[model samples]
Target: MALMKKLTVLAGAASAVSYVRKNPEKVNEAVGKAARFVDEKTNGRYHSQIEGAVRKVSETTRPRTAE
Candidate 1:
């Protein structure tokens, strides 16, 4: 159970990163949705982990590219 939770956090973090890279403008909205889903699924036990992931993703989205 612990290992599974850890893996979920890692995977969620990775996905959040990728999502920001793929869609920077929607990063906050998307990460928020993902965080809610994860928190609900885990019964709120991993809210911090998911929020951390979302925050990292949100940060990534905040920076603009040279374009």
Candidate 2:
């Protein structure tokens, strides 16, 4: 059970890395969606932080396509 848990964590981490690397546009879209969700939940109180976070996520998740 413990080993399975460790494997699950590893798999999730690896998928996260690959998702960010391969689908930067998806990452950007997801970030935007998340920001919007938060803004709606907070009634726009955290717009600055949400936008900043989305921008940071987009900046960090640049695509790495090989030709």
Candidate 3:
């Protein structure tokens, strides 16, 4: 049962990665919304930390264009 659960998680993760690669903007937007919801729920307890992590992820995942 544990092995099956792990496999299911891995499959879901793989699918999510493929979707994110094809739609980074949408993923980022979703992340932003999730962070906001958590922040509001927690009354800004982890707001800065969440924002920083999201910013770093967005920068890293963004597609670079030739100048």
Candidate 4:
């Protein structure tokens, strides 16, 4: 049962990563909006941390270029 659950989670994660690679712009836009919303809710108290997270997520989802 535990193995099946882990496999399901991994499959979902793989699908998400594939989607992000194909639609990096959409992912980045959504992330940006979410970050903005969080910043507003926190009154900008965690602005730096939010920005850092946004950057990391963007980088991770960005498509790789062939050498």
The model with the greatest TM-score is 4
Q: How close is candidate 2 to the true structure, as a TM-score?
A: 0.75
Better of 1 and 4 by lDDT: 4
Give the whole-model CA lDDT for all candidates, comma-separated: 0.83, 0.87, 0.91, 0.94
| Winner by lDDT between candidate 2 and candidate 1 | 2
TM-score of each predicted structure versus truth: 0.56, 0.75, 0.76, 0.87
Clash totals for all models, in order?
A: 0, 0, 0, 0
> For model 1, how does the per-residue alpha-carbon lDDT over 1-67 read when each residue is reduced to its tens digit?
9999999999999997686678787767866887898899999999888888988877767877798
lDDT by residue (tens digit), candidate 3, 1-67: 9999999999999998799889998989988899999999999999899999899869866998999
Put the candidates in TM-score order, highest first: 4, 3, 2, 1
Choose 1 or 4, whichever is better by TM-score: 4
Mind giving the per-residue lDDT tens digits that candidate 4 earns over 1-67? 9999999999999999889888899999999999999999999999999999999998898767999
Candidates sorted by lDDT, best first: 4, 3, 2, 1
**Cα displacement (Å) at residue 35, model 1:** 1.0
Displacement of the residue 24 alpha carbon in candidate 2, Å: 0.5
Query: Best lDDT goes to which candidate?
Result: 4
RMSD after Cα superposition, model 3: 2.4
